[model samples]
Target: MSIRQLFRMGMVTVALLGALPAAATTQLRVDLSQLSRDSDAVIHGVVRRVESRWSGDGRRIVTDVEVEVKEPLKGQPGGTVLVTQPGGQVGDIGQVVHGLASFKTGEEVVIFLRKRGTQAFRLSGQAQGKYQVVREEAGKPAMAVPEPSEALLLDPVTRQPSTVVEKPRTLAELKAAIRAALTEPAP
Candidate 1:
């Protein structure tokens, strides 16, 4: 091939590579201690409402979740709080942001929040900070499980890639861990 033709082919290859979707989002793995220490507030709550709409700039869709606080583990977030996260379905259009927490109405959860504005909050460590509360059966104790994510997580201290297969903990155990973490010095 001529030099000019080779250059044009190279340009096309570069353009195509850039157009491909990202394989996975990457972030540091946040453990329970980090979640407790970094969060402005941590609360166990039930999702009262979930609404998705276009952002003020009209560039993206965001979901606002209203959580009724059942227990405040860290800060005084009051009876209810609004937590917003990027991506959601709005009308017939939708956006999905990988490694972000998703909330559903009436679902029970323990959320680690960071204050954004006067009254709004966001997840402390994105997907790592949200744990769903589940019960196997009626009268059984509930379990708290970290929300699953497709993101690649790196170790915070080592900065090396890490894989975490979290095991579900009882609600009591999770609460205890959070409380214990609260007492330890921040890293």
Candidate 2:
């Protein structure tokens, strides 16, 4: 083949490869009430350590977050809990799953967890299941600020995908809401 023809073919191959899209993940739509009802455990804690490792199948990356539980709102939990989330940086390789909850060491948070089996647990609604603990102002007590994952949501009212931004709620207010939901009879 001519050099010019080879060059053109190479250019086309590169273009096609560039056009290929990355893997996509979809998070289910879940309201506050649904998150509260569906979760197996609701925990308030501070992240103590985060470790990234490969899944058992060695197909994907997963992060193990060790959190020091301050309180357990739903299920009985000990002082510390290990929460697993998809995607993390291990060595030089990192896999990022959009809409997955990410935790940082020393960060305080409230997480809605769903148990997988005998020991494993996952976030109930990805990012919607996790809330960061932040103070409204200096000297003020901290509140739970939900991490924004609007792009990965489906509005319950509209039954369509849309962005829903939630305002920060005080710890007391959040706990009260969860308690109220817990009191309601299950469907």
Candidate 3:
């Protein structure tokens, strides 16, 4: 082909390249099967220890949050969030909430947690994940739900997940919901 034609083709290619849209980013999709019936949502726990610099260059924030991951404190923390990934190895996790600072040594805390992928369902994402916190007038302080985005990760199949917490639910209201769930009758 002629030089002029070659030059024109190059310019057209450049123009097309410039018109391409930017690449899309993939958001972290946390496994939802990690949570439990109700208490396995998110809760706010105190920072137990901030190990921002894990096994290496300190790129990953490794903090330990105190919350209860096992039985009894299923939803909250009397436990800690450990570092999962670090040292550029993607060590399962990357940060932890070791409970420290502003959150006294033995202060109470709220957190959203679930079984660690490598542990016996021990809570991991103490502060690394979701869980909305609320104080009840009944003297029972705790959390109800996780961060809003978490609703999206609940059921991958359900394109439109619901986050409705029953605007005006009372103790009786909650009891009714629980009762209904229990009476689902093996469905």
Candidate 4:
């Protein structure tokens, strides 16, 4: 092949590699109990807005999600709360932090939140800390659905794959569980 042709092919390969989506380097495997223990606040709310922007340091992209609190299972986050998570698109550039929880406007969710400094809160265990609320049937109340990625997890101690079977529960039941967890002594 001509040198010019080889140079063009190399350029195309480099561009294609840059366009590929980022893959998760680490998988989070936290059960409900662990999520509760790690979180400072557990809240059931609807996402009111989502805003993406570059971090103050300009090192990474972050998304700020405003959640209108319907109930506070732990802590005292009244009214609206801002939850920040890593990963977002800014203009032509985009960054995807795999395993990070994402939120959409008007979406209902149950979130286990850990305080970041004094102002922001983040998911305790990435996707494992966020639960989508979905209706079971027409005219039925909504239930919290755990992340599908949690279906299979690697046990930290054993370093072996283990299936995590999550049972659907109503919002009230989930709140109760969080309350119970709050009363228990931390391990």
Worst 10 residues of 3 by lDDT: 96-105
lDDT of 3 by residue, 3-38 (tens): 999999999999998985332221223332232233
Which portions of model 1 miss their true places by more than 4 Å? 1-22
Q: What is the lDDT of residue 29 in candidate 2?
A: 76
lDDT of each: 0.92, 0.83, 0.38, 0.82
Ranking by TM-score: 1, 2, 4, 3
Q: Estimate each model's TM-score.
A: 0.86, 0.80, 0.35, 0.79
Q: Give the best candidate by TM-score.
A: 1
Please write out the lDDT profile of model 4 over residues 98-121, one tens digit for every residue.
667778899999999999878789
Q: Is candidate 2 or candidate 4 better by lDDT?
A: 2
Query: For model 1, what is the error of residue 153's alpha carbon versus the real structure, in angstroms, after optimal superposition?
Result: 0.6
Q: Report the C-alpha displacement of residue 120, candidate 1, in angstroms.
A: 0.5
Q: Write the per-residue lDDT of candidate 1 for residues 75-108, one digit (tens) a residue.
A: 9999999999999998899999999988889999
Candidate 4 lDDT at 153 equals 52
Mind giving the per-residue lDDT tens digits that candidate 2 earns over 75-125? 976788888888898889999888877788999999999987766678888
With a 3 Å backbone cut-off (N, CA, C), the pairs that clash in candidate 2 are: none
Where in model 2 is the C-alpha error above 4 Å?
Answer: 1-24, 136-139
Instruction: Provide backbone clash counts, one per model.
Output: 0, 0, 38, 0
What's the CA error at residue 136 for candidate 2, in Å?
Answer: 5.5
Model 2's number of clashes is 0
